[model samples]
Target: MRVDDFCDYDNSFPDEFYACLPRECPDCGAPMEMSEALTQLHCSNPKCPSKVVQRMVAMAADLGVKDLGEARATKLVSEFGLDNPLLLFSYEPDKDGVPEGMSFDVANGIVSQLNAKRRMTLAEYVKLAHLPFIQTSSQALFGGYDTLDEAYAALEEGGLGYVCRKLDISADSDVSVRAARVYETLKMFKSDLYQCIDFVEIIKMHSAEMVHLTAVCSDEVGFPFKTKADFYATVNNLYQNLHVEFLGALTRNCDYLVWAGADGSPARLTNKVKKARAYNEKYEEHKASGTLKEGEHEIKIVSAKQFLYILEQLVK
Candidate 1:
């Protein structure tokens, strides 16, 4: 069976069963190569539209550029000739863009989204590179190391040593392999220096088993708005303030449900806070009943600002 098939019955594969087969990409009919280690293979042709689209998909997804789906990405290249992610965000005076059939406003809107995405945190950009084994969840994996001066430090501290130490698993284990891949990918990205992009977007993904965000800029102290006009913004800011994405909080699997609000008031609780409280309750129940595993996140709600202050003290 192929690597993708992945041991229908066994996790380990015998050496004799492995062999490269002559293959052609069904999408572009180009010759494809597969490493014994990799589960999936793609067309060898870099210009292949299908191959490009998936890369685009990875970039857009990591950058959080909404609505640039595979269908749209494919159309952007095959139909409109906008083949590059940078180009997707950019527009020329002559090209009436966006996959032929889409309206002018829609095309402009897509470009607008792309422009907005240009400004992002370094973690998000690294995630966008779509490097092998660097899943969104692994963003938190970097936090385990304490001495790395730069992200590239993961290649040193967070690589094998990190795996063996924090994970308490072999450095060569599959899980460690994933961490090692992140280190390798970061090195590869660093080779192409980026000067204009803001490195301040570089936010630390804190090491936690469980974390729940809570904050709502209500009528009280909420900035730039009156009467909770931006409740969602409050919840989002909590994530951003932590230098963690909304999804990153989940990935770190924070054990604490840090509640940030004006007096933990119900009226101030956004949907995120409410949901977190509910989830925390479930976690408590499961833990009490002994259904939760050792590594499973323990849930507790700490004061919001205080919660962050702790991170400030620890991370800084």
Candidate 2:
């Protein structure tokens, strides 16, 4: 007989099976709440030991620290009485005793790995924080800010109402409720969980897609363009197929400096222009001294006409 034929026609299972399952979380003894769909049971306690261990393992992986699997995380938590995953960053080999099964060297290696990842992008920090209902899509809420301080200041000043306004979400919408939860969770985490590590740097995230080259246009008017917006539209339209990205500022990664102003003219010597030229000079000096690393290239300074010509040839 086929297995399907042997099974009951109805999907219902025996009531005994449901009774066999525990109604409470095994580790934390918290009541387990059944989902609305009745497909899964969720422990209501956020501080449940099992959940904490899982979070510890996940946070370690997300932070790029290797070898911090579930078993190791459990051992660390039990040994150190760790209440929060972020506390792992504070573990000191000199001050703390090694876990029963782990050697001092292994523990030290884990600390070293964690320390090496002190510099993280803002997006990475947000993901690691694991704020409630906040995912990658929420990153757009932080657009236009180049530093965490600026973003945090705005959030503090405006609160969840600010986030809803920025996201164009109605206050009574389901998404607004989620945004409120995320805001409250972020505030809670910032005070305790986020203070666990002394960060070396928190780089601002860029929302643009990756491109082979990035160019910055001078705001000063010059040939073939009357305004900055006109320059942007013309060049960007012509070079859309050239894998080149444009930005308003001359960051370190910029590959081209497009300026239509006359050479050495006051209008041409803006801070961006001067910075790009200085960078090129430093890059050349490094190249001549045999200290330049591979893949390092100087920013090419070009006028609008020259840039358009270069892009035209490149597309061909």
Candidate 3:
């Protein structure tokens, strides 16, 4: 009953499930898209230098902004003792490595600063996008402002600055880095959810192993199992004895109900139906006794696929 024995295992990579940038940029008020070549970064700006600077400043502010509104001048002056801010701007256009008229040291230093902060806030990101290098499209990378309104609203509300200020406070004192950790934790949560869905889909492909399929609606939910047509086809074809029931009484009575399978067999389908009826009765009794909350209870409904996994794991 090992997972591999019953299920044909597929090693779908994690990147397949991860979220990507939305269709537009959130800065400089332009559309953002990938290039067909995928070798270089493309920007909404037709002018190349502004695109370059936008990209670099985005990179620079990857973690957070060290200094807002100030050009890389102060950092360069303090660290490298550059007498003239213009001295840092020399570059060669033809060279693919570092573009002409851009400060590599400054870019590198900004990158370091960003990494040190370990997170980026929306305000810092906007500030970075508005840098002189980005505006001029110098030797830097480009940034896009796809959702201009939403991004701008976040900036105006000071949410972005609050996040950065909190991070700065954490660096200075014993404050928790919760603001910084929020982004990383959400990403991990999404990764885990993807993995769970992948497991459920893999269980469905095993037609012989599927015993019972039931649909108990809490809300009309759709899943990524190919398409609506494909999902219905898989369920109907694999589990021909599929049962569809409306929890008319239970939905009106309880917050949630457990959709339990009986003896791990679709042939014993009457038992599951009976169990569902009894569950509603017991739930009502508990509700009358004031043990269950009127509006807050978790209902556990089983998918035919999920039930199969549960049965397999129990047998092992």
Candidate 4:
């Protein structure tokens, strides 16, 4: 049976199966067996550390991002009828095997109607957006605003407006930035980065189990240090492997790349000069051999801070 198929028959598992509250390990992405008797989950990997350091890292990562008190986030999540993390928000697939519709916005609206005073976290918003919905319209998942951060702040402040105001742009503009960030963030986790384009446009995944972060204008460009050649070489390969036409289109229209997938280290754009040099040499040889036609093919490194500035400019 397919690994994911087990999720469908989870109910078939005896009460003992769930009594312990077992889960997957965040670090190694391995299944963990929980022991209520021990009050902890154990990773089967004998050498795997308990991921203790990650806890502090996770907390630090959430420094400015979370506003809703743990109590409020928890309460709001429960009140919004999102008891199950998996049901927080989900996307229905279209005939093309892409996400067809989402009920997250409707869920957000419901949460607002239920409790106007409470705010939601990005994780909560993700959960709500993933909630199953039978709606006929609304293709995007995790609705209510364009961006996850905005939606999160709104959830905390009892509105999306405060987040919009922080962005210093019209609500719709902030929304666009949010959408772009979510797409980019998800892409970082998947094998096929471009597929994230369609995933953002179609499937509505939520952020509970992932890290959600965005760089703001407070970020100054750090000192420009030349990166190691190894990194740039990888970038060159990534650029070459990608469809240049697509990159050109993305470079022109894209802005802030808000990420919400795996969160540990912040995403970075390192320029590997040596790798780039090698790539150019290869291109020259390929052209001489009639393998690669002369063309301007390159990759764009959109840093988190740069991403935010780009979007701010776009909105303005």
Instruction: Report the C-alpha displacement of residue 256, candidate 4, in angstroms.
Output: 14
Write one digit per residue (lDDT tens) for candidate 1, span 1-316: 3333433334455745444333567777776755565665656654566756786776665444556788877777677654334344445423754456666776676666555445434544544545455555344544442223454555555555753464355675677766565555555445322432342233334545323242322223333323222222232334433443333133225544444453454436555456566776777887899887556564445454554555566434
For candidate 3, give the lDDT: 0.35
Weakest ten-residue segment in model 4 by summed lDDT:
240-249
Error of 3 at 244 (Å): 19
**RMSD, every candidate, angstroms:** 10.6, 17.1, 25.1, 20.0
Model 1 residue 109 distance off true place after TM-score fit, in angstroms: 0.6
The clash tally of candidate 2 reads 0
Give the top-scoring candidate (lDDT). 2
| Candidate 1 runs further than 4 Å off | 1-22, 26-30, 34-41, 44-49, 58-67, 78-103, 116-119, 141-149, 153-169, 174-176, 188-316
Arrange candidates by lDDT, descending. Answer: 2, 1, 3, 4
Weakest lDDT window of 10 consecutive positions for candidate 3: 137-146
Deviation of model 4 at 306, angstroms: 8.9
RMSD of 1: 10.6
* Candidate that beats the other on TM-score, 1 or 3, i.e. the better one: 1
Candidate 1: TM-score? 0.48
Q: What is the TM-score of each candidate against the true structure?
A: 0.48, 0.55, 0.20, 0.23
